[model samples]
Every structure is written in C-alpha cells, then in structure tokens.
Target: MDIESLAPVVDSILEAAETRGGGGDRLSVSPHSFPDAVEAAAADGRVPVIAEIKPTSPTTTGERTEDSVVLAEQMVEGGATALSVLTEPSHFGGSPEALDRVREAVEVPVLRKDFILREEQLDTVAADMVLLIARFLNDLDRMVDAARERGFQVLVETHTATEVEAAIEAGADIVGVNNRDLTKLEVDLETFEEVAPTVPEDVLLVAESGIGSQRDVERMQAAGADALLVGSAIMDGDVTANTRRLVTTEGHDT
Candidate 1:
C-alpha cells in the first residue's frame, strides 16, 4: 500500500486538525444544527442540499471555474444550505485548507469531502461532517467511532447492496448512494436502488453523482432521499444558475 500515493496528504490534514482541536464535547453540542442537519432535513421531510466542491472528475466533463475556496464562497453566496468541500489532493485538487476556508466563510454545515482513512482524519478540525464511502466500509468502524467520539457526523456512501450492509453494520445514520463507481467511474442514476431497501428507518438517505435534473431530484426524494450530494453537476458547470435552481428547490416542503 503506497500510503504516500494518497495517504500523506491525509496525514498532513490530520496534523492540521491536531493544531486546532475539536469543537467542544459531543454530548454538549449534539443538539446543534451541524451534526443534526440530516436529522433536521429528515424530520422536516425536505431535501438537504450538499454542495460538493470538486474541481473536476473522470466521470464528468469540464473543470472547476475557479479556486475551490473561492468557489465555495460563491456556492454559499448562491444560497447553498450546506457545503461539501473536497479535501482530496490528487484527483480532486482539494485541501484541508479549502475545507477550512469554506467552513470559515459560511455558517452552514461544512462536510470534509474525501476518502477518509483512520480516526485522526475525523478529528481534524476541517469540517463538521465527514464522508465515509461504502467501498471502504470495512474500515469504517474505527473512523466512525472517531467521528462520533469527537462529536462529528458521518455520511457513509454506498454504491450497492454489499456496501449498504457494511454501512448498516457500522451504524451509519446518514447514507449516500453514489452514482459513480470509484474504480471504474461508470455512472448510473439508480445506484441508490440496491441500498434503499437496506437503509435503517431513521437514517437519512442522500443521492449522489448523476443528479443533474430537477426530475432526478424529485425521484430521489420519492425514494426516501433527504439530501443530494451534487458534485460535478454543480461544481464545474454553470455554478450560479444551477445552484440557484437547486437551493431554491431544496427543503421540498415549500
């Protein structure tokens, strides 16, 4: 495992987190809006919006319009309810600082969007929410424990029923159905189908990847999705226009 091939950047992020410390005790802040954003969305029967700050992706065309930090500010200004800042360095051109910048710029909950590895990554004061991809769910226990221990929330991702089993075993309350395969980058709109049935009754469902149309959003909502992890569709495209459309329509109860 050439941890250096990818893990060092994550290590550096961990070091940065050690420098800032977590935001108080978990039990003390458990009732706060950040960790409970998903629950709140689910309770209100609304669609939570996760603005993924990806510069570019193999599955999608085009690239970021500007620096991720700047783009994150732009997303917030455009009415994003929550921000998902990519912290992966190589493929996504993201950094802990980008997460930090977005968290610093906006009051809405900010999620550290990346392939999380170890407990330390969750302890890093980068963002309030952490993304746990299901393909790697086998290792999710320690990481999820760390996040919960630090009063952070986890968004476990699943691409199939197998991964869904892993997420449920690990007690993930927020699940993401990724439309893109990490290794192959193939996309399908119905990626959530396999995991939808297996999702815990209380867990919040999130639709990820190929969410480009409003109709697509509606369908996911019907499937019990409380949030959408929209990335390339919003990040590298006509950001303002798409963001305006999505944000306005978010929280479906309106």
Candidate 2:
C-alpha cells in the first residue's frame, strides 16, 4: 500500500479533531458492550460474524443501494453478533454520521472501521470497538493506549506475520488477520490460515475479508479464527440472509 492513499481519511479525521477541540467529551459514547456481544454470539460454538455497514469500497465499483441503518437492523435481526461501520469518507463512502446512525439503530456493539492513525481520531468517533491497522500506525503502542483510555477495545489488524507479531507485542486483545492485502487490493484466504497459529490462544483471532460462503467461514474457524468480519458479500445481497448464512454455518468437530 502506498500508505498515502489514506491521507484523505486522516486529513478528515484530523480536521474533525481540530473542530471538536481535540477532546472525546464531545463524542457520543455507545452503550453496547463489544467483547460481551462477541462472546454471546460465539456461545453457540459457531464462529460469530461481525456484519459490516459499508456502501462502497475503493477496490470495487458496485455500492449497496440499501440504507445503512436499515441494513444494520436487518443484520442484527439475522443473528449478527456485532456490527462494523466504515467511517472513512473518500474511498469507502463512509462518514462518522453513518456510524452514528447504525449505532443508534442496532443493539450490538459497533466497530469503527476506518484507517485510524491518531488518538484524536479515536476520540472523535463513538463506537464500542476501534480498529488499529498495524502497518499504518507510526506509534502503535501509543495509539493502542489512546483507544483503551477511551474505553474502547482495539482490534489490531495485521496483514502479515511480522504485523501479527507487532500486534501481539503491543498487547492487543483482538487480532484481525486481514485476508485482503490493502496495497494490492487482493483477497487471499490463505493469509489468515498461515498466520493464525502464531497468535496466542488467549488472544481472540478474527478473519477479515474474502469470506463468501459457509465453507469459507468453516475454513477460517478451522484455522483458529474465533470470528469473521464480513462486508462486501453481505452488502451485495439480502443483509439478513447473508449474515445468517455465515453465522449459522457449522464448523468441523473440535
């Protein structure tokens, strides 16, 4: 990834921070419990799915026609354990307002899925969980601390084995192995399977991207993933049915 591709998102977040006086007091906090919600979703011994609310993507041209809030409600009704809302504006066609709308419409914990770089950005958004991409941060530990201070659980996203190690070194409680390589915009399921074992058992492992079917969900679970973060596929069709299919898919015998 050029890394610079995220400059617009960062600029917008920083601008919001400046406008808000660089404090979290102005942000509306979500009451839903993220970790607890994930736990309950996984209680059935099936991998819980975090259905995402994304209208568009830089990698693809087709955008979902449904309203984000309505889609969030449908996903929740379809048995989604948690929700992820895209907050990046330029490429993903997302905004903090979209996240806020979804958070208000659903009871599940909502994750602010954006190219988070600074503490100010974390403070500016209201969500139960925050995403910290390992490769994008100049100071991973500092940003992680910032997220924690705001009472948000961090989902440290990694694309490689080295990034996974860095996430673990930063004491990340949830490690998301992104199957899609951000730089190339390519989806490879094997990436998660190859790096999952390196994560400690105590830390939760999440497989993000390229999960298109029940077999795909099962494969990730078999590779030691505790959860799945599915977006594009769910947004492309009936949100409720898509989420139900992924969540209800049975994995191999443990």
Candidate 3:
C-alpha cells in the first residue's frame, strides 16, 4: 500500500502552533486508564465499541445533531466502551477544544484520532489515548516510544500486512486496522477482514472505518477484532442505537 501524505495537515497545525507563540496551557492531566478500561470491557463479553465524536469530514458537510459533549455522553450511555474524537480540525472538523469537552463529559477512555507527527502534539493531547498511523511515520518506533513515555496508550493505525508488522514491532498496545484507503478515501470491509487475523492475541485489535451495521460489527468480531472504532455511521445516526448495535455483537465469533 502506498503511504498517504499527511504533511499538509501537519504543516497547517505547525503553522498555527507557531502563530500562537508556541506554549499555551496544556490539557489538564487525567488519571483515567484507557487501556485498562478497554481490556476490562472486552473481558466482560462485550464487543467494546469505541464510539467516535466527529462533527464533519473532508468528504461531506452538515451540522451534527448535537455537540461533541452531548454525543460523548450518549455514546457512553449507549454501551460504548470508549470514545474516539477527531482532533484534526482542518479536514475532519475537529479540534483540541472539542476533545477536551468530550473528555470532560465522558468517563470512558478517549482516543485522540489525528495526523500526529510530533512529540509536542502528544504532549498537548487531552485524550487518554493517541493514534499514530504507521503509514505516515518513518520512525514508528520512536514515535511509539515518545507517546508511551508521555503516559498515553498508543493506538497504532495500520492499513496492510507490512504496516501491521510495523505496528507490532513498534510495541503497539492497541492495533487499529483502518479499512478506508487514505489516498482515495474509499472503504472496503475486506481490508479489516484481511488484516485482523494477522494481529497477535496479546495486542488489542480494533477495526476502524466502514462499519455501518450490526452485520459489519459481527464480521469484524469474526475477524478477531477485540474492539471497533466507528465514526461516520455513529455520528450520522442515533449514537446510542448505533453503539448498542455494535456492542451487542460481543458474543459472535470473528
């Protein structure tokens, strides 16, 4: 798989950071344990769906039914084991402020999903966990180490067998198999089906993207996904119902 360039987004974030004079108040520290919560949720015979708080995407535009905080509460109440907040503002219509609000409102672990490229970004992250895409990083090991040192659970995103290997080699605690092709922004559920079995039993496996129905959740569960990170589908519909649909698939064999 060809690696997609996230430099545009990274550059924009850097420019904004520079213009802000580099050093604002950091996100308040939290002692909430994301990995432990996720592991416990999975151990309890639930699919452990990680509901996402995404207001918009680069491919579409519309107002979300409720604010991030409101949605966060709904997801947790609906049976979401965790949360994934889009923190990339330019393309994904997300921001640190949104993450902060959601994090404050929910008790579950929050995954900060963004095109993270530097240690400083991790330093300021308000979520309990951080995403590091293996496709975008040249030094995956270093980035993983940096995030780990900051007391953040690392969710390494992988798109292929090679990337999965890189994620494992980098010591990823949670490995996310993203079905969407970053270059073209298209999705095929088979991507997760093909990649999930390659993940080790020790590392938590999460299927991300293109999950629209209970059948999709069952398929991922059958494919060995321990958890799921669903965004657009959950964001577009009833958060509670969508989350319940996914979580209720826990007893299936993937």
Candidate 4:
C-alpha cells in the first residue's frame, strides 16, 4: 500500500484514539527490555527472531484464528527472543486487547506494531516497545520522545537509506529496516542488505518482512541485522516449529 492508501487506516486509528480518549492508563505489565533480549540472543550466536502475532494482513493469505496468547507461548517455546503483536484492527485483524493478552502470557518483551501517527496513541500501548514509522510521520522526533517519556522503547522503521539516517537523527535507538515497500507491497531481501550498512553500529538493527527460511535468516544476520521480525511464515503453520527453524538454524547452510 502506498502512503495515500494508508489514509483510511490512519484516519480510523485517529478516530479510535479520539473516541477512547487518551486515558493514559496503560495495562499493568512488567517491563521487559526489548533491546536486551535481541542483544542476548545475538550474543549467544543465535538468530534472534522477534516472532509476530499477526492474525491477518493485506499481503498475507488466510486468517489466523488461534488465540494470540497461545501463539505467543508457542513462539517463545520455539526460542523466539521477543514477540511483535499487530494492533491495527482494520487492514490487519488485530486489536490492543490481543497485545495485552500476549504480553501477559509471555515473558519476552512485546512490541506493539501499528501505523502510529500520533503520540496520543502511545498512551494506550501496554507493550514494552512501540513502532514509529519514519515515512508516515511528519515529526519523527516528537513521537520518539513521546514514546520514551511514556517508558516505551521506540523502534523507528525505515525503508531506505535516507529514512535510516532520518530515524537516527530523530534519536531512534532501535532501527528496523522493512524490506517490503509500502508503495507496492513487494518484498526484497536485498532491501535490508542495502540499507543495513547505513544504520550506525550503536543502534540495534532489525530486518523486517520477507524472511521465511533459515537461508533468509542467515542472509539478514550476515547483513548486520541484530534481529529479524518474522510474521506470515511463522503464522502460516506450526508456529513453534517454524519459529524453531529460524532460531536454531539447524540443517541449513551457514
């Protein structure tokens, strides 16, 4: 989807935020260090997979009807370093309630993945981390600061080298390079490889989208990704085994 295509989704989110009114009452859950989890997995010589709890998406086929909490436990059991819960309800069949349940069910840090347009949206976020897309927001720095002030770590997503640099300038400590282009909804493994070098070594880098196999995992890791955010592949079948395949990297060429 292109930037214009996202107008309706963004509008819906804003309307929801308005209707709910920012109560600033985030769910009561113990904070887990998102970056620490990724770093620890990488330090252990393992591919840190931030498995996602995606029920449905615009690009993926089929809908996941399983309980979000059950799916989260399976991923963790399969050795996922963390979890990403999609909270966008329109295009992606997700809700904040799902994120809350998953966070309570797993010890791993949970990232609230949504097209966050305003800082007020952060008030309702209960996860350990919040995703802020650089291409979507006009003032990225303000959103980053707002998330931090609310005690939430920020994952600034970028699609190109310029976006990566902009994310860094916006004071983003964690940068995620999304391989899928929003304009065409296309996935390219080389996108991460091309943009990974632009991310500073100090910032934690996460390769997002289009990663499904052990070879894909190796490719991203080799390109300097501290972690991989995997969705459709893991959600497709046998969540645990799928997660294990990416995490263990066994029987696959190094």
Q: What is the TM-score of each predicted model, taking all chains together?
A: 0.78, 0.87, 0.86, 0.90
Higher-ranked by TM-score: 1 or 4: 4
lDDT tens readout by residue for model 2, 1-254? 22555445444554453343233564445457766777887776545899998889766678886788998999988888899999877667788888888887878889999876566777666888989989877689888877877778889999888998888888898999999876456789999999998999999889999998888888998999888999988888788988887887554222
Show where candidate 3 strays beyond 4 Å. 1-31, 43-45, 250-254
lDDT of 4 by residue, 1-254 (tens): 12565445455655554454343665343469987897788787668999999999868788999999999999999999999999887768898899989888888999999877766778775889989989877789988987887788889999999999889999998999999977667799999999999999999999999998888998999999989999998999999998988898568743
How far residue 198's Cα lies from its native spot in candidate 3, in Å, is: 2.1
Residue 252's lDDT within candidate 3 is 36
Q: Give the clash count for each candidate.
A: 0, 0, 4, 0
- Which of the two, 2 or 4, has more lDDT? 4
Candidate 2 global TM-score:
0.87
**Top of the candidates by lDDT:** 4
Please identify model 1 stretches exceeding 4 Å from their true place. Answer: 1-46, 123-125, 250-254
The sequence of per-residue lDDT tens digits that candidate 1 reaches over residues 1-254 is: 11223344344544443354333323312312553665564465445678788876545566665876677777766666678887766556677777777777777788878766555445445467788766543477676776777667778888777777788888887888887765455678776765577787687778888877777777777777777888766775677666666655554421
Give the alpha carbon lDDT tens digit for every residue of 1-254 in model 3: 23346445444544454433211444335547766786787787677888988888764568584788988988888888899888776657787888888888878889888877666677665678889889877888999987777678889999898999999998887899999876566789999989887889888888999987888887888898878898877887788877776777444323
| Candidate 2 colliding pairs | none
In model 1, what are the clashing residue pairs, if there are any? none
Instruction: Please give the lDDT score for candidate 2.
Output: 0.81
